[model samples]
Target: MLTNEYLKRVYEGLEKRNANEPEFLQAVREVLESIQPVVEKHPEYEKAGLIERMVEPERIITFRVPWVDDQGKVQVNRGYRVQFNSAIGPYKGGLRFHPSVNQGILKFLGFEQIFKNSLTTLPMGGGKGGSDFDPHGKSDMEVMRFCQSFMTELYRHIGQFVDCPAGDIGVGGREVGYMFGQYKRLTNSFQGGMLTGKGLTFGGSLARTEATGYGLCYFTAEALKCMRNDSFEGKTVVISGSGNVAIYACEKATQLGAKVVTMSDSNGYVYDPNGIDLAYVKDLKEVRRGRIKEYAETHKDATYVADCSKVWTVPCDIALPCATQNEINKESAEALVKGGCTVVCEGANMPSTPEAIEVYLSNGILYGPAKASNAGGVATSGLEMSQNSERLSWSFEEVDAKLKGIMEGIFHASYDASVAAGSEGNLMVGANCAGFLKVAAAMMAQGITY
Candidate 1:
């Protein structure tokens, strides 16, 4: 633990900053709390002012994006790009598009990405950007307009060897296409490697959408093997969210011989006693873009709950929260524990609050944090960048194999770090410290720079 005097000084310095973002503060607090021991052990890092630099971003770009709607009405939205670090390499992260996006959330995500990207053993730094634009219910023209406007400001700050952005929560293939198109028109160059998660025709790799979910399962498989000497075969699993990550997780879990029983979206959840069919889930979420309630309509044995928060009450051996941050609080964690869940893997960023994590740790349940577990998507994106650079693409099977290897390697890295840090089995702290130490070392070697 940090000395009371040291913490007080740190808190005072934090209070004086103009950017007192709550989400960013929360993320920093989590990381700092976990790494206090490391701070004490490594006096050289403290002397080098590593933690101080780690708390702040290198650059933040904010701009207004103006677009025209279908009705000839002009719309405007705020945009942001937080280049959190570049100690390892150029900035590399996702560009989110959602109504809830803001500087605070983006900063927190970017800060986390610094460590997460480092853990992948790839030459990529941390960055994140997004806008307060809601893509849902928007026409293709509106989305295209917004993407073009966004890329106009963004293109100036990004490139193939500099910064590469990919899709996140609200940004999908359509959004990537729009942004890439605008970038091409302005730069007058293809430069396909400047972005990832593109359409297959343009340069996107196969199984990129499935990377995160399949990677989640692969990491969880490693954890299970280490903890219980077992695998996913015949184990019952429950996953939340109907997005790309959730659907892919369901697919991977089913392929690994687990019976996934329930999947949910913001509206509600569908509990299928006969195990969720991956084909039906893909059709509903990907093809139809319908609510999870549609699942219950087709599968008579499944029960649909309109309120998603209540879905945790269903029983399962493993729980995969692939939804938003802080979705599973103490109450939800308790419900999951009561339902016989022995493992909880997060596919979403910070899905479990600190309270919920405490509950899991105290109960001796195996918990996988998002930074360490959900890295497969970005890892595969890095692979896509490699392919683009080489002017070649690997087959789906080859890419999937590489993704599995990376996930497994990350799991073992986190596990070993946890054990060595004397917080054996406490993966959250271990992962944060492992990732932070690497970035901090790189920063120190490079020396201080603006």
Candidate 2:
């Protein structure tokens, strides 16, 4: 229930227009509900129709992506790029390549990026693009062809100083390399700033690969220290996902004196009470591209469960949902609360459902929202963009130090915003308000645009 009249009207309008877009609606409602305080404080925003304009994207590009497989079979996939807002800076976000890619999901992600970028204290706006073409089980050649086709139309809408797309979900370094190569060939120039998450030999920044996961831990450590006078030391952490974020999160958690007991993929989750072996998980998931079940098979002490959601059932001090959107539902939230989980930080965008978040908040858990906690990846991406613009690369330690400082700053901002809003320790509200205030101020300063 949005208390502000203008905010409620804007949300109702969004619902009418995006009736079928539950994800986008959820994202919109969450932010709108959180920002009622700001709306009440600044009635000028309503008179200027800022909420209406901000909820709607500036441009939505949809096109048919036709590519051929290794067997010469032509396949068609739908691609989309939603340039949500650029009031603060250029449109910057990741290009996902999952089968679930749709206008609704992209819009939700783009909307979230607006604030996520704002939280980074960087001059980057919100945009997200992706195709429904799944890269899993595809041959290298097939993936390359798809990337080429996807970039063919996308190149016209993006540039170094304009929209910059990086990797998300199924899109990784291999896919980024393919897309970067296509963009370079299409434009006939080496504009490295056009993409992040590229190979080190290309324009990718140091610590970019580990930024999100490592940053999750850093943010969590700050929250723990501030709220509970504690840290990750001796905490039993359970992380969801076997991808880059989870793997590196596990590595960083281990380094920070925490034991990561579980890591999961879509198919299932593996549990090792003695703390997961980061080396083997990385080798299996990153290098071999194998499923997480292999970890249980190789290590007799571990057990593999077919249901990935059950990973939350294990008792732990902290939980990091690093997998995907809405992964932690109400039932999972209940499980975490019942199991004595004190903190839940999102390493993936909108990983917890509204119900799940409500449960966590009511239970007095220190919840770190994705926009602030997961901003590390894009923060480092911003760093990559700076490096590319200067044609200079910083060392791993340099980038890592910067990433750490940014994550800490995000925590404090969210914390202070929460306190100022009278919500005390509610990070979701704090993050939404903090992130939105920055972009909203910039929008107001720039004046109205028809």
Candidates in order, TM-scores: namely 0.97, 0.99
Quote model 1's TM-score.
0.97
Candidate 2 lDDT over residue span 59-138, tens digit each = 99999999999888999999999999999999999999998989999999999999999999989999999999999899
Identify the runs in model 2 with alpha carbons over 4 angstroms from their true place.
none
Any runs in candidate 1 off by more than 4 Å, and if so which?
1-8, 15-20
lDDT tens per residue, model 1, 255-333: 8989999999988899999998778888877777778898898888999999898878899999999988888989999
The residue-level lDDT of candidate 1 at 213 comes to 92
The residue pairs that clash in candidate 2, if any, are: none
Question: Cα lDDT for residue 246, model 2?
Answer: 93
How accurate locally, in lDDT, is each candidate?
0.88, 0.94
